[model samples]
Target: MIKNIQRTLIELANIHRFVMRFYREVFMPPYEFKEIIRQCYVVGWKSLPLISLTGFITGVVFTNQSRPSLAEFGATSWLPALISIAIIRALAPLVTALIASGKVGSQIGAELGSMKVTEQIDAMEVSGTNPFKFLVVSRVLATTISIPILSFYTAAVGLFGAFLSVNQNENTSFRVYFDQVFDAVTFLDMFSLVLKAVVFGFTIGIVGCYQGYHSSKGTEGVGRAANWAVVMSMFLVFVEEILIVQIIQAMRA
Candidate 1:
């Protein structure tokens, strides 16, 4: 038990060092703008279709499930505001991050892990290249910038799905439903969404890179790195969500 705890602590310390190195390298010299843009396209644009489908389904299912309860309480009219708050404040960010952790995070880990196991990363370093900056920094920045935009897109799509459900059941007009949604959502909610998205994005990117960069030798190690990246990213995302929610609630109080 003590050995296990010590291993965990050591891993955490290594991760902290990796993150600090990233911070230092990110601002140094030749910014890989081209690589960053490419990664953004790969991470952000490639993710849109899945995000859209998931967001729409999530909104529809959540609305359908919540309707009966609200109807029972004669609060069906509050559906728009309720949906808006739920989606914007929590659901969108959480869903987006989870999906990205599974999708983008795993991809990054596997790609980098493969490069590492094959000694491609070593070759780059041996050459005049700053492999960490070119690879890790660009990908991390891509995830960080892309996720907030994706979260906003998810929230919008979710609201649209909710609107469809509400219109079918309550005959609420589009404008009226949207107006109510806007009315209920404050600056705090928007701030929370952006903050959560950015933090989650960073967590996913950093964890994936760390796992891949430090993966063991062999093909099995590549698979293990990818798996660990997804698991760790999702776990950290949940932890961050809980902490952020607590902080937000405290601010609200």
Candidate 2:
């Protein structure tokens, strides 16, 4: 048990060092603008369809499930406000991060692990190229920029889905439903959404890159790296969500 704990601690320390190095290299000279843009296209644009689908489905299901409970208290009219607040502040960010973990995280890990296994990364180093700066920095920076944009898109789509669900039973117009949603959400709520997305994005990128870059030397190791990337990214997302929520609550209080 002690050995296991010590190993975990060591791994955590290594990950911290990796992250610090990433921060230092990310801002150094010779920014890879072309690579960053390509990564952004791959991460951001390629992810929209999945994120949109998840958001819409989440909104529909949440609205349908919550209606009965609200009806019990004669608060059925509060559906839009309730769903909007929940989706914007929590559900959308969490769901989007998880989805990105499965999609973007896995891709990054597999790609890098493959490169590492085949020694392409080593060849890049021999050719006077900083592979870490070119590959890891661009991908992580792209994730950091992409997730917040995806979160905003998810919130908008989710609210629309909620509106449609509410309209099935009542005659709430788009303007009225949106007004309720906007009224329920404050600046604090918006700030929380952005903050969570940024943290989650960073977590996903760093964990994915760390796992891939340090993958063992085999085909099996590549698979392991991809799997670990997704699992660790999702785990970190929840941990980060908890900490951010606490901090936000304290600030509000």
After superposition, the stretches of candidate 2 with alpha carbons farther than 4 Å from their true spots are 1-3
* Candidate 1 per-residue C-alpha lDDT over 133-251 given as tens digits, one digit per residue, 9 for 90 to 100: 99999999999999999999999999999999999999999999999999999999999999999999999999999989998999999999999999999999999999999999999
lDDT score, candidate 2: 0.93
Model 2: per-residue Cα lDDT at residue 147:
93
Model 2 C-alpha lDDT per residue in residues 47-162, reported as the tens digit of each score:
99999999999999999999999999999999999998899999999989999999999999999999999999999999999999998999999999999999999989988888
CA lDDT, every model vs. true structure: 0.96, 0.93
Error of 1 at 37 (Å): 0.6
Q: What is the lDDT of residue 53 in candidate 1?
A: 97
Model 1 scores a C-alpha lDDT of 0.96
On TM-score, the leading prediction is 1
